[model samples]
Target: MNNDIDSALARFAGAEPHAGLAGLEDRVMCAIASRSSSSGLAMGASLSAAAFALVLGIVSNAVPLAEARAVSTLAPFGAPSPLAPSSLLLEPR
Candidate 1:
């Protein structure tokens, strides 16, 4: 290895290792983390808001709600269920 290259690498790895980028890293991480957290919080909040609205609609429409909703069904109306939990693992006895 050339002495010049060796010395340059040694100094680079030994010292701050690019002072400008190093300093910028902390600030960048803080900004990124903050933005990510805020975005996540906003998304979660919006999901919660939508869920609340759905529940409110269901509750308010309960009286006029379809009676067919009482029975468990896999289809929109009624049909053989392909996705229902199977009791095949239970003892036949």
Candidate 2:
């Protein structure tokens, strides 16, 4: 049974190709090449956009921003908290 099936498959595989099959490989290859070329263009465009954003970020950081200052003077607090070790050491034993 295996030999019979093998012989039948061999006969089918040995059959000649049809006329419409001509240049099919070339057409398929051309389609694949066109798709790859479009993807390459899209990749380049995205990379260009990323580079522009990076440059913009660097340039913005290079410039100095405005400085902020306190509007009113600060008053002195009476003493350091007794819980602090330094304050405890300063006190008479």
Candidate 3:
């Protein structure tokens, strides 16, 4: 079945003169090569950097005792002591 269709298409195509693209293929290939050579990159790096910045900001502000290093007590992650004064208002009276 496919052979008959192939023969019919070959006969029909052979009956016509070949009308080749003057420079369209070359132009299209050049365009593809140029695009691949000087390509646009996805924004994964930018997004990762933004996420890192956001995490840093959140960590800096999230822990209330983040800056309390003077107190003797220490959390499991080596964080500041809960008894330490992170703010001026929390200093010993």
Model 1 lDDT per residue over 4-71, tens place: 98999888788865556767978998999989877977898999999999999998787665555545
- Candidate 2 lands at a TM-score of 0.36
Which residue pairs clash in candidate 3? none
Give the Cα-based TM-score of candidate 1 against the true structure. 0.29
Q: What lDDT is obtained when candidate 3 is compared to the true structure? A: 0.74
Please, what is the whole-model Cα lDDT of each candidate in the order they appear?
Answer: 0.74, 0.84, 0.74
lDDT of 3 by residue, 1-93 (tens): 579889999899888655775688899999999877754453566788899999999987987664555546467566656655573467667
What total of clashing residue pairs does each candidate reach?
0, 0, 0
Predicted model with the maximum TM-score? 2
Give the deviation of candidate 3 from the true structure as CA RMSD. 17.4
- The model with the greater TM-score, 1 or 3, is 1
* Model 2 worst lDDT window (10 residues): 73-82
- Candidate 1, superposed: residue stretches over 4 Å from native: 1-37, 64-93
Residue range with the least summed lDDT across 10 consecutive positions in model 1 = 82-91
Selected candidate, larger lDDT, 1 vs 2: 2
